[model samples]
Target: MRVLWLSSIACNGNTHSFLNYPYMEQFLNDFEFIYHPVIDSNYSLKEIVTETIACDILLIEGSISDEFKRADVPVVDIITKYAKIVKKIVTVGTCATFGGIFRESDYKDTTGLHFVKEVKIDKFKDLLNKTISLSGCPVHPEVLVNTLYAIKKSVDLQLDNFLRPKDYFAYTVHNGCTRNEYFEYKVDNHKFGELEGCMFYDHGCQAPFTHGSCNKILWNEVNSKTRAGLPCMGCTEPTFPKSNLFGTKKNMGIPQDLPLGVGKRTYLTLAGITKAFTIDRLEKKLFDD
Candidate 1:
């Protein structure tokens, strides 16, 4: 398949991140890479701008914009040209899938391919049948790799409403966190820098409610943010970067967002019961220490 990497409106972090994926070497050999800004290709920006490249799968990165140009040619025009020929459009990164951090301060009416923030875009009717959104600040390289492998093998991936593959987004980050015991018992991490307790209460850790396999996949194959004493930032969610980064929003002491598939009333009741116990073993981040 002839795959093209088209970008616009933000940092090319997804491209950089994907290049470092463990399966990158395998992907390089598997696909016919037509054009990429960072990777060497047979086609140049001049050729791409002037001619319609035959594309099978289009991998678009960065936020979509009308004004952004490459080789003095509008990226939207290039995208449209490829969109007509490609059967699958894999939008990598939150910028291309959901507009991400760029739309928060959009100076050029920039938006995502299929959805603008949380709403679907009527213009991208082509994506209705062919779009696969891998939304993350920088999409997890394995997620992108596996998605490609599945496509190459003709595997039918179950996708959510946002076109995100459900296999990765169905579970919350809290599923495999080391702080599960602390979170269950209602023990909270008082401040940052200590990897001892859960960051859900005082800190704005949205692992429980946010759907992502970050903790399960493990970034860099060594550790995840929660395991390294950082909050889950809720980057995968559409309403990411909500007002505060390190603080949680509450209403009468109840978190605005409850855990995945959990009801608010049930959660509050469970919280009250869980806090009633005093298990010293759960207090520490490590059991042996």
Candidate 2:
């Protein structure tokens, strides 16, 4: 019941996401909450390294680095020391579970805390069985809450190849999307903020191919970035923000990436057919100012 939360080389986006949980306060009541970066009952990095706290669970945030220097000490060494005593370890956020955007920089020398881009490290193999990964640009709050609840209750939890819980990531972002109707009819939104057209074709939205339930759960209990005139950006998928996010990928006038299992030829053929029969409603504004 004693949890030791830690972070390294991150902007604290996951912490912010967890704070937005509707039932966060209620859900947290189940655990002792021994330690966290921005919550009750926590310790500083210096205190953690000094072995001042004894914990049963280790929750890591942000990417790991072998050479990351913090106050003249390496964070990787600090985490490994705690990993030795903890019964369970949870890597929160894509940065901690899988090398994220921060890894692009040289100084941080960042990589996932456990498996570095699908490649596992032997140093942490002994603790793999106790490890649970919650990956997202900033992990969804529900994912963290549900995982903790499952562990505390000692219930069986299903996980995928990446060690992520199945319940939350079982479906793609395309599932239950409001713009699904437009996607089915091959309607493409030529510009940002159009509610009636799909963003996959011309706008670089990755909802169809990316996994997660942004559309199903709905962020802030109202809408997601995609639903409110923004694109999915594939924040949950491994290959996120693929080079030059401002534009879509195309190879020979066709989208370089297709929906989950869609064939390139089939997608193009359908797109051509749908483009020929442009509906006036799809082209006209759905809301008036």
TM-score of each: 0.95, 0.89
After superposing all C-alphas onto the true structure, candidate 2 shows an RMSD in angstroms of 2.4
Q: Summarize candidate 1's per-residue lDDT along 105-194 as a digit string, tens digits.
A: 544877888888789888787657888889888889999888887887878889998999999999898989987888888886556776
- Report lDDT (Cα) of residue 107, candidate 1: 49
lDDT string, candidate 2, 1-289, tens digits: 7777777778899888888989866867766666677786766656677664788778888877877755467777767777888777888888888777776757445677666666766656777788888888988887787788788787778877778777888788888787777778876665774566677777788888877878788887788767775668887765654676656688987878788888988887988888789776766776744
Model 1, residue pairs in steric clash: none
* Candidate 2 stretches greater than 4 Å from native: 42-44, 69-73, 118-123, 272-280, 287-289
Q: Considering every candidate listed, which one attains the maximal TM-score?
A: 1
Q: After superposition, how far is residue 11 of candidate 1 from its true place, in Å?
A: 0.8
Q: What does the lDDT come to for candidate 1?
A: 0.83
- C-alpha positional error of residue 120 in candidate 1 after TM-score superposition, expressed in Å: 0.9
Clashes (backbone N, CA, C under 3 Å), per candidate, total 0, 0
- Tell me the spans in candidate 1 whose CA falls farther than 4 Å from its real position: 284-289
C-alpha lDDT of all candidate models, in order: 0.83, 0.76
